[model samples]
Target: MDRLHSDPGLLVCPDFTNECYCASCVPFISATITKEQAAESLCLVWVATNDDLCIQWCHQLAEETCISAKQAQAAAAAEATHLHQVHQLEEEMAKADKQKKNRFKHTNILMCPCPDTNEEEAFVSDFVLQKIDKGHFIEFYYWTNIGLEEALFSYSTRDDEGLIPSEQDGATVWISAVASKPSKQVVPDRFLSPVDFAQAVPRVVAALKEHDWPNQWVLMLARFWVAIMTHQYWNSNDQIAQQALMIYQEEQQRAWHNAVVLGNGAWDLSIISNTVLGRLFDHVLCES
Candidate 1:
């Protein structure tokens, strides 16, 4: 990255399929080249779009990485072992199934940071989580304006019938997931823009850096195509932004119902925000 950026024409074809694919053309490709690097290469692709050389590296990396049948079976077995407590195997058809609703009291919901940073608040409300009681498990992505990737929060009670907080008027107290961990020092509540987000990233990163995860984690990633920036630009009054917020609240209401059926009292989740969604803050400067 350093060399390529220093001389804008330099390109490197990595052997990694996800990074770039056509290293065979590297000699003619005319950019600096590396056979294999570290995971940091993938990190760059995740954060920033890839340049020409990087695309070639990613294609090669993806084309070569395949699992053997033996390895695949072993992996399947391991997943079953880990999920045995929550899921049951019906060997007849060889399908995995959740234990009967009467058999299990609660199911756990996992969440994590959204890669886009723009839809941090929207990740929860916009994606809206729900337990089986209300409906099926759904996955989604949304836009948020924050950049910090380490902030985490979750509820702890799983047995309460009405514990999960939705957008409804009355709800239980929701807590920060990683408050026990160290993180930022925001003195007060205010709408933050990209500039303010830069100031807050360090603190948020500090709070979530401690844990090694296999736990339930959710990531909602939106790209330049998402509406996150619009909330801050076109809808400066927040009336429009509030529509997204309402979407979140309704999702919350649904989550509350699902959590009741899933028997997860403390394990439910909620969004705790000091700022409302609007075009008045950080998104304006960055929105394309």
Candidate 2:
């Protein structure tokens, strides 16, 4: 057991080996192979030779991965169905916005640091701000320092069914900032442009640092801000962009539901925020 624990890689079959095929057929016969290792070997075996032995080994691996073969089948079916639904959504979005090609395409300048800062600080430029706010963009200023419970109380109200409404405005611009600043400190109702918002980033970072917020939290906030900036730019008249925004909002709503309604309330803002940035990054920035 100690040897297996220390060198789990030993149990993993080397690529294109006879042992890889044999181990999948008789998993228990191999004392060195763990369940995970056996399952992986089975996959490789099946990919190489789709024979009766491979079929049996496939079932065996599925059983080992999930609680039961039935559950595994169900999970596989569910994933297939979800993928089909996503395909349908994409098609519908494409057809609906056939006349709106390249509507979401824009230059993103917020991802990098300001060139004038000697590479010391990141700042948003007027060009980016104008681009992101080109249409009917709604600005959102969220306090990053507050707890999840506090955030829920401040931002949303629950219905009788205890569900937060999913109908968030698509054009909303979410900007994370420190909310506990002094009363005398003047904060804007809306950031006029990217240049205006860029100036606020350093102050928020400084406050977060001084208050001893977790380094992870600070980093997450920064990343999320970038994601939000990306989101604002993408949430344009383009059909794909609109569809992506819809999907993003659904994810955010689900996250809020899980956190507040499901009582798993914790600092899980990253889950949804990261999704926004990741899904939109390539679509908005990379495509020609």
Candidate 3:
């Protein structure tokens, strides 16, 4: 035992020193080592005592260290990818916010149909009239609770020799109202008269109150209705008017189905009664 301790080669092996010290057979070393340290040192001791066990211990330690390194690398990579995605989402949100601010700064024109003259007329706020110039095209956006809707109009001087005969030489603006449905279908041009619009106010207000819609929402809906009314007057020969009439008929049918067959509320019924179909139905009933 003394000869083994005296040997420099044997003393260099930590596993042997740990075993001898723990057994109270050696007093050369006072400091204690951990189990892992002892096990790692066992590889060197095994090389002298048992070669097979030494090879196995060395291989196991190498594999465990390699696995730990790979796991740390994978964790670091995952954290970086997550940070990159968060940055991209923030950038997209900022860009959308900037676009929304720019769009809201412009004023829109509303066009409505006259029930007495059977013609379409454009309505612009005093502020818009002051700012708008001839030959300038204006684009306006309407918020419909569900999504954004856009309309366009261009200002031009009317010539008496042009398609529509005008008594006075004045500036005329042609406006188009485009309704963007949830299904993304573009329904262009609808009409409303001043008398109808006046009558509609109370009914729309009542319906909105009954349905518990916000007061601001009523204003938005009113603006949308006025925008649709600004197109060409109802003429069977006009292709655009005809298309608008077709879409109106389809919408009325769908509303009727929802109300009568699908058990929708009075709000849907009110919508049906307020449109052209309601007037036509009343006329038919009066004739009969």
RMSD of each: 30.5, 27.6, 18.8
Per-model TM-score on C-alpha atoms: 0.19, 0.25, 0.26
What lDDT would candidate 2 get against the real structure? 0.44
Candidate 2 residue-wise lDDT, 1-288, digit = tens: 011112222244445335545644564436787665666666676555445444555566565567676787999999999999999999988865863565345211234233233222222222223322332121222222122223343223322223222212465443323212122222332322344344444444444444455556556555554554456544465555544454454346345435644567646444445555457645654552
Order the candidates by TM-score, highest first — what do you get? 3, 2, 1
lDDT by residue (139-217, candidate 3, tens digit) is: 1211111112111121122122134222223765432212111123222213332333433333333334344455444
Tens digit of per-residue lDDT, candidate 1, span 126-145 = 11222211233322211123
- In candidate 3 the C-alpha lDDT for residue 23 amounts to 41
> What ordering of candidates by lDDT runs from best to worst?
2, 3, 1
The lDDT leader among the candidates is 2
Q: What are the runs in model 3 whose C-alpha is more than 4 Å off?
A: 1-49, 104-288
lDDT of each: 0.35, 0.44, 0.39
Evaluation by lDDT, superior candidate among 2 and 3: 2
Model 1 stretches with alpha carbons more than 4 Å out: 1-194, 198-209, 213-218, 221-288
